[model samples]
Target: MKRLSVSLSAIALIAAIPLLGGTPVLASLQKAGESIVQTLTRPQVKLNLGAEKQVVAQDQSGKEQVSWKSLEGNAVVQPGNILRYTVSSENAGDVPAKNLTVTQPIPQQMAYVLGSATNSNGAKMTYSIDNGKNFVENPTIQVKLANGKVETRPAPAEAYTHVRWRFGKSIDPTTGVKAAYEVKVK
Candidate 1:
């Protein structure tokens, strides 16, 4: 999945925006033994992203098991293969980073697996069908019925263009979170 790499640094910068308030500002002063000093700082979050291919193995009894193989270092990806992408973030600063959101764009020629997105940090997940322009918890589309009436229905997996996870709680110092989703190569 080398070809499917995302700009994780860019995402980290975006996640830091809310805390930076457009630019770094003087935060507060700390009193230490009759001395007061002003400290300017912001949350520093380290972000990482990786891709893996799902493998299904069968035993002699025909029992199926699932596993993932890292897609790094020249791994070959082919059509109809199922791939899982994981995004991880850790706060390395003293301050807690609030309102952290991670958005990952679906790689071209891949179809999302519905309901496959998961977050370990208890985040509110959303989907985008218009190339990340807009996102909703459940994306729907208008469909025309045989009776010439229009109906609203859940969007198809192929229509999914991006996945986003927004965390309600602040990420404390030295703590981390993870989010993952699956997609099928088209």
Candidate 2:
């Protein structure tokens, strides 16, 4: 009778696997769903740099006017020319992307234009002067004085190392946000 009781308990425990909703099969199914979601919902970002061009435009006045144009594709830039760098972020997934942030390094041998950074789609912009080690709305640096004292001053345009944009809201699927900043080639 004791052996029969032990056998019945073992059978009952085996039957409880599915009934308790804690079986390995259910766990694997949950993992599969998570994998599908992760694979389906991902953010895609595209970055580009363009040079500004001065174009001559002729209107009905029979006179030519100089206009600024953005040379976007395969642009050729020279020293002392202004270049605009843009970042476009799009959510390719079926769901919204949360906490979307885009960062771009300042091109070497270039100087960032003060207050030229702009953000679309309700984003916040920040600057970093320490090779992306830190970010702030107005980046500054510490200068050590000869008297053994340090003073913080506004960072120069040439000191900018990176720019970042942080989105406050979620980015909807198939929707994109654009951010840009201007820099002068050294």
> Could you tell me every candidate's TM-score relative to the true structure?
0.78, 0.71
User: Top TM-score: which candidate number?
Assistant: 1
Q: Give the range where candidate 2 is weakest over 10 consecutive residues by summed lDDT.
A: 45-54
Off by over 4 Å in 1: 1-40
Per-candidate total of colliding backbone pairs? 0, 0
| 22-70: candidate 2 lDDT, tens digit per residue | 7687888989999988877665443444456545579898899866677
Compose the digit string of candidate 1's lDDT tens values, residues 1-186.
553455776678789887777333324222342242213346788999999999999989999999999987988988999999999999998789899999999988999999999999899999999999999999999999999999999999999999999999999989989999999999
Number of the top candidate by lDDT?
1
Please, what's the RMSD in Å of model 2?
Answer: 6.3
TM-score of 1: 0.78
List per-candidate RMSD values in Å. 18.1, 6.3
